[model samples]
Target: MSEQNVIASLLDDLTQMQSLKTALCIGQDIAQYDLNKKIQWQYFNASDILNLPFTQRYDLGFVVFNDDLNRRSQLERGQIIVKLRDLWAKHVVVIAPQGDDAFMRSLGLTRIVDDALQDSQQTLWQFNILSYKNTPDWLNSKFWANPENWNKFRW
Candidate 1:
């Protein structure tokens, strides 16, 4: 499939993980991509993202770094990621070229995608957002902590 199509598919997959009430697509186009209707998607660019106000209004925020748009040094990129995670959205997804794998990991994000597509290097890197812990899975679930009694016990 085409690179754009592949990226679009990846985005679709992410929405399935959880019901996102809203998503903000920064420096990328989502109109061509079919996403979950349950999600309200907004696309925009800021000349100065660092100085933008912190509203934490969106459920998810995407920071797509491209040469034509949203170009910045690694340090700047790190700062933007922090800003987005802390103030702009509850969850953040970063889409960028394959660079140092450790960079995103160091920032507490997990790499979720690496694929090649038509007419381009086909190599892309996707990082997951920080997962905040609101509850423990075992607290109310009817399952045991040990596998021997997983089917018959509750914590």
Candidate 2:
């Protein structure tokens, strides 16, 4: 790509990163205020800084998929969003990795960042903002909820 195209792509990617942060924030709030009644939290960090605990958590991470999960076709967009919101509302930290434009294109979304300039192979680009949700007491009441008794619908 020409230098101009590359620069433009990077800027576009940066913008997408901002959008992702906004989505996450909205997702987080929906979980706390709209969906899960028991959870509570506040926005604690910006997406760009990795020095803080927000950068430390590994259990939660997001990757923009190709939307090839045909098995998940029955699920509604609101359902997926609700699930994500619940997780964030529960204080689970997630990072939405920037994906390739081609991948994004396949999903009917455009790619923003270019990997060559950034010297990184991963598609996750941009530093947006980070939000937090309080952990629920029911889960912590046990090391792990027994699968036998757990309801698959809620889990």
Candidate 3:
């Protein structure tokens, strides 16, 4: 193989390794959260979990907490929306719910796609706070970090 091909192969391997690590870390995080709740699996669909009343929303935030021994920080309920926005902006997750299709339609919200693994799907929605459809590089910039910009691009 040419030198360039060798370099490309190495890069691909590194990328896969990084993705594997991320998947592992995210999995561990979910396990820890579920353990805290005394549940085997704690992930729920975006639809079943969102559009909740204020009180219910707060409860949902608390339940997502990863209270594992390795988790020293408390769950940041206030920051959940911002995190979700980032996820949605990245197209890494959608906001589909698993129940009450008509309710979502009534509210004019698109149902979340349910084809992905439950845990994987939840991870995407858990981080999706904005309605933005495109994942732009500018999402990483500080200006776009503002919660106001979250509404700038709704799906």
On TM-score, the candidate that comes out on top is 1
Give the Å shift of residue 155 in candidate 3.
32
Count of steric clashes across candidates, in order:
2, 6, 9
**Cα RMSD for candidate 1?**
7.2
lDDT of 1 by residue, 7-91 (tens): 6776677778766777777776564565546677777664566777765578777777767444566787777777777777777
- Look at candidate 2 and tell me the lDDT of residue 61: 22
Candidate 3, number of clashes: 9
TM-score for predicted model 1 compared with the true structure: 0.67
Tens digits of lDDT, candidate 2, 1-155: 34334433443443444322232332223332212122222332222212233322222222222232222332332233234433332222221233333433332322334445444233432222242224678767455756766775464
Instruction: Compose the digit string of candidate 3's lDDT tens values, residues 1-155.
Output: 23223223332443443321121111122434221232222344333333433321211121222333114221332223333332312212223323324533433334434333354323123222244346777767674457767867775
After the best TM-score superposition of candidate 3, give how far the Cα of residue 137 lies from its true spot, in angstroms: 25
- Cα lDDT listed for each candidate: 0.65, 0.32, 0.31
Q: Which ten contiguous residues of candidate 3 have the minimum total lDDT? A: 19-28
Clashing pairs in 1: 116-122, 117-122
Candidate 1 lDDT (Cα, whole model)? Answer: 0.65
